[model samples]
Target: MPAQPSPAQSAQTQLERGNGPEPSTLDAHRCQEVACGNVLRDLYEGLVTEDAQGRLVPGMAQRWTVSADGRTWRFVLRPGLRWSNGEALDAGQIVASFRRAFAPATAAPFGELFDALDQAQAVQAGRVAPERLGVSAPDPRTVEFRLNRSASLPALLTLPIAFPVYLPAVRRHGAQHTRPGQLVSNGAYTLAAWTPQANLQLRRNPRFHDAAAVAIERVRFHVTEDAAAELQRFAAGDLHITEVVPPQPLVSLRRRFGAQLRLSPYLGAFWLGLNTTRAPFRDAPCAAGATRCDDRALALRRALAMAVDRDKLTRYVTGLGETPAYGTVPPGIAGYTPAQAAWSDLPQAQREAHARALYRYAGYSARNPLTLELRYNTSTPHRRLALAVAAMWRQTLGVQVRLRNEEWKVFVQNRKQRAITQAFRGGWIGDLADARNFLAAFGNDGPLNWTGYDDAGYRERLARADAAATDAARNAWLRAAEQRLLNDHAAIPLYFYTSKHLVSERVRGFQPNALDRHASRWLSLSP
Candidate 1:
């Protein structure tokens, strides 16, 4: 283990991340939540990773080439690689990790990513053996992969799922593989300490291939959700970095912090999703003898969506540089154009009136109002949004809404298991700068499709878009597909995201990107 820095020295190197990442579980393969992703990125190096500018950069796989058919991808591993435990990190270990991801026993949360590999479907379904999956290693330093389709795989591998797993540790310790003593990381940093729902501290990994390039000696990420409280901590100098910035003090913080107060566009959408499998929210008529179950539920969805004043949500509530979102995918992603819902064209009054009419026609009134629960993770902004939107639904359409919130970790678990019974908050940060990354999640059996929206026609549009020969043609198909989705109101698009954070002046190499990703390894402190 590396020697610990003194209290005075640690103060200069330590970074305080106010309540964003929750270290619920450290096993990256089993954990899909961003909290775990943040920890894993610090602990492990993937075959590929996005640079500070959000471009593809080499990680474990130093360089790669594609076959003439574009279906076979080969990569060369960096020689003399060693894990934090001093174990060799070679192509064989990489192949084994990928096989584990595809095997039926491991319920890999991002296992959907493997579906792109050849024979992955059969391997995942238990039809074909796991060893038959399309990963091979001819030598310790060479890794080869055969893809089922033609796509730029390096970009996909940038996701956390593609990060190499230290198999020696995992094979020895099953569930507790990532515990402090058991874990072996090859990244710039390794887990030094984790006090759940409190703080996670990371120390520089001495065995990292390029540890000399790393600047920050230690990073302490603190769990903080309240924007106001985090701002206070930032002001007190107790926190060197925090993403939670209060909207009320934006103008003042700009004056005080100046360049340190960072506000940039985020390539993400904050929306609300209605569970399509549950009773009133179901996509088809329930067997409970209600004839208007399906049609009326859809009408109710559109009515609720139409009643929202997106402009107001973006203006007063968000108060950052966010925009009203009528579509799922945000603009600026490659091959994407904004798509608007039918109600977007109507005047505010007319939109509300139409919503009211739909509400009444769907057999919902203040006397017998359609009651539903809206769930969100613990955050002040979410509470404010839910309250404001609930007020709108009541005033515009006489719909009754109840707001519920839980810690982010528990909420994510429930959401993934389809335990959320009604509408829940959902925000998607693009894994890569592609429209397909956002729109592909809604197709039939799409991994990110939490709404349970399954329409053959909509799925066909996505398929056509995926199969299109040209970017323009694919974008057209995607636009039509988005229009259909918004028209059906599968999920209500509330607003786009704006990354707001505070970085101390002492911190260097903090380039602001749309993805808002700043790896601790890239950061250094000025003496």
Candidate 2:
């Protein structure tokens, strides 16, 4: 932790941060983007939160304990907790918030995350009412959760979807509860103003429990979808921190900004998601075989996965200090080792030859190459990466590729529906510092499983992993699940992401973490 600057020592009490496009909503349970999570963390405090280094720390809950069986958890809230509106916030409201998030009518995007809770799956499926959820308020200051199976309650609670919402505001204003004037939060900040696709202003919440320790009085998040434009803003001293740096000008930016440029390993994976629910990528039953299978769709997917040169892509197109990912999960997670594809150790030339053979086996050749469309969101880096990938496939496998780009919102919707998406750019940033967060996304019912990979074997492996009682047992199951995913060629892993940003020297307490989470409450603007 860094020393906080006193009001007299700092000339400005507000910090400006560059971010991506506007969040679709400010509701913690509904919003899905990382940028939205960043803002929501400041406005709403979960029972468990992270410190500057992304380690789990106490937030609204002062302390918590789990039962010996690990199926039940209890949390004791801090004294005198209140919403930004100055109304007393009690444990009952917390329970109500959890129920609202899991209600079938709410359709929370990440509702699957709470499947561990007792009756949660049934509640989300409309089989049971939301009131049947496992969470309960034992007393005004105590909230309890009963899980049907063992899970890390602390890690689950740290996610934004687990954060409590103000039910009164929602009841009074409906969907408009998230608007600036109506939004009532309990974190270190309150929504002051918002202009979509432009910027949002957050002022310090005096009603926050730990407001006395907060240093920055205001945080202004400017929408910076264009990395080049964001870089210019940073160079012009208009932003104290940038969301991301353009990869193409890395050499010059590093030379110009020096220590101001921040790059650190991130717990994320950039991958290409092949729509397994559609043609060319869908899998079929394979004949009984010891070491070979005659599945055309499987062959096509493997060929596409092997054709790409991830090392070259990272070196030339990304330019950022990223590792070529052979597996879905990135490195550095504790107690787990990621499994790579079988061809990961093969030479590039040999890999290309194998890919070409597979392509031919899948009924494609120089005379009749497979034609496919690759979709990605409109951005400079995304365009460059798509072009590089297209060129790689064309050169290595003689595949005809078409590139299409859409805005952020439309792109997300299309990807989720998977109706028009053949192959699309997809990535995952870990919500928790756990391997489960990455591998679970490939599960048949995974909330973020946009690839439409529905494998009973894969789902079984994940279930075993989640039910394992010991760490070693759990890790083995996770390893097996990852291997299964890789063998199926469900998605092509390109590179592990590295967090890139430009931080002005005046900003203090902006510690870099693998999770890339930095709250404004801990940051101070120094003179």
RMSD from true fold, candidate 2: 3.7
Model 1 lDDT, residue 502, Cα = 87
Top candidate on lDDT is 2
lDDT of 1: 0.80
TM-score of each: 0.94, 0.95
Clash count list over all predictions: 2, 0
Query: Please, what are the lDDT tens digits per residue for candidate 1 over residues 1-527?
Result: 99966888876777666647475577777766666776677777888876777667888888999998678998998888998878778899889988887777876756665556889878877899989999899999888999876667888787776777787788899877887788777888898887777788888899998899987888888887776778888889888888667766467667888999888888888899988778677766467766654488787788888899998888887787789998898988765786888778788889888888888877888789888898888887888889999998888887788888988777777766566658889868877676777766677463467787877778889778767777898889988888888888889999988888888888888777877777887778875
Supply the TM-score for candidate 2. 0.95
RMSD of each: 2.5, 3.7
CA displacement after TM-score superposition, residue 338 of candidate 1 (Å): 3.0
With candidate 1 superimposed using the best TM-score fit, by how many Å does residue 449's alpha carbon deviate from the native? 2.4
